[model samples]
Target: MNPLVITVNVKSTVYCDFQLRWYPWDDPHCFLNLKVTNVPSFGLLVDGTSTVTMRPELLEEYEVVECRLQETPHPTNNLTLLVHLTRRYQYHLWTTFLPTSLLAAIGYGTLLLPLEAFAERGSMSLTTLLMFIALYTETNSSLPSTAYLKHIDVWFVFSLIFLTLVINVHLMTFLADSESAGQSVRPTPSRHLTHVSAPPFAKRVRDRMAVPKRILRMSTVLFALVFIIFTLVYFLAIV
Candidate 1:
């Protein structure tokens, strides 16, 4: 009797469950398992295996870092293919990180404006708040919802809160000025005829702004420090 030679070809689809806490920066190590059946170990002993995968579509999301093939010790023959992948972070960094950061800075910049710049401050903070919400919605939609907050979620939530706080500060300042104006400007009796000179307009303006100026300066410092500490914690904990 003559010995027989057989050639087999197989194409397969694999499902990888990735851990998404790190999201765009996640580098996941996954595995594929193949179970050999029917043939005994002696009958399947002589051939080597090779992979010829072209990963263009995969490369769009991740870079293939390494792959290893090994046999598991099992009653049924088991082969495990280990694959290590690093996510492509540029897209998220540009679309998500940079824009959100710039928006946050713009929101904080409103605090630096003149203490009575109600309109400009309100407009800028409101616009940035809306934009931040839209970005967070878009980003969240692209990802599967998880029970725990992701690193990106932390940034989005806190940034939204900061913008909201800025708007509240603006609103309070506006209301305070409105109330002050209502009770103010009572006519002084014949100051025009008195010899006592009135303070210059610039000096009055400076005097009126003193308390608000100090409050705004403190706000700017506190807000700036909050942002800096959050940024540092984020990078240290996540990066």
Candidate 2:
């Protein structure tokens, strides 16, 4: 008789089960037993996964469990391998995630630059955005095609979103600063000739010019908070 063969594919870094079953031709008169050869002569496992003698990039290790059942019309013995595989996140956390995170933090650094120096700030924002895109592509290339999202995917997506917000915030501040700078300056009446207090309307205009600065500060704080929260949530959930 030919040997039975089975194949399966895994999508996520989660626990999975693989079953090997055997049934006898005669249930009561004859029975079948099963035994698993951990270290097969043909080399059954490759780097803790059932691969063709070559280590894979993302998977780690597995576990095996066995059981038997007699309630069925045809009694059978089953050997269930409970495979516990984890995404190899150490390298990604260092190379992909760390660089992306640092770029995001540095992206906010542009906010510290002089608002009037639009060229410098705009250049920094554009560079950071490109870095994020490159890192995201590198990370994706390492991963296999899967229908569902993985833990690592969550981190990259959130990081990209944060960077996008930073760029938009800088853009808002830039426009506000430009308009304020171009406004016609109202000359103060000769203080030497007459002691005159500043008009209420003039004070209101000055106060409004400060709004953009306040928005920049608030946005910085918000970005920092969100980045920290995302980092914590992602690591905690995956680990």
Give the candidate number with the greatest lDDT. Answer: 1
Q: What would the per-residue lDDT of candidate 1 be over residues 187-228, giving only the tens digit for each residue?
A: 568846767566786776666555556666777898899999
In model 1, the runs with Cα more than 4 Å from the true position are 1-9, 41-58, 71-76, 179-208
Could you tell me the lDDT of residue 94 within candidate 1?
A: 93
Tell me the tens digit of each residue's lDDT in model 2 across 23-90: 00101111232223443444332232223322333324221122222232322233223222333335
Q: Residue 153 of candidate 1: its Cα lDDT?
A: 81
Model 1: how far is 88 from its true place, Å? 1.1
Over all chains combined, what TM-score does candidate 2 have? 0.59
Using all chains and alpha carbons, the TM-scores for the candidates as numbered come to 0.77, 0.59
Name the best candidate (by TM-score). 1
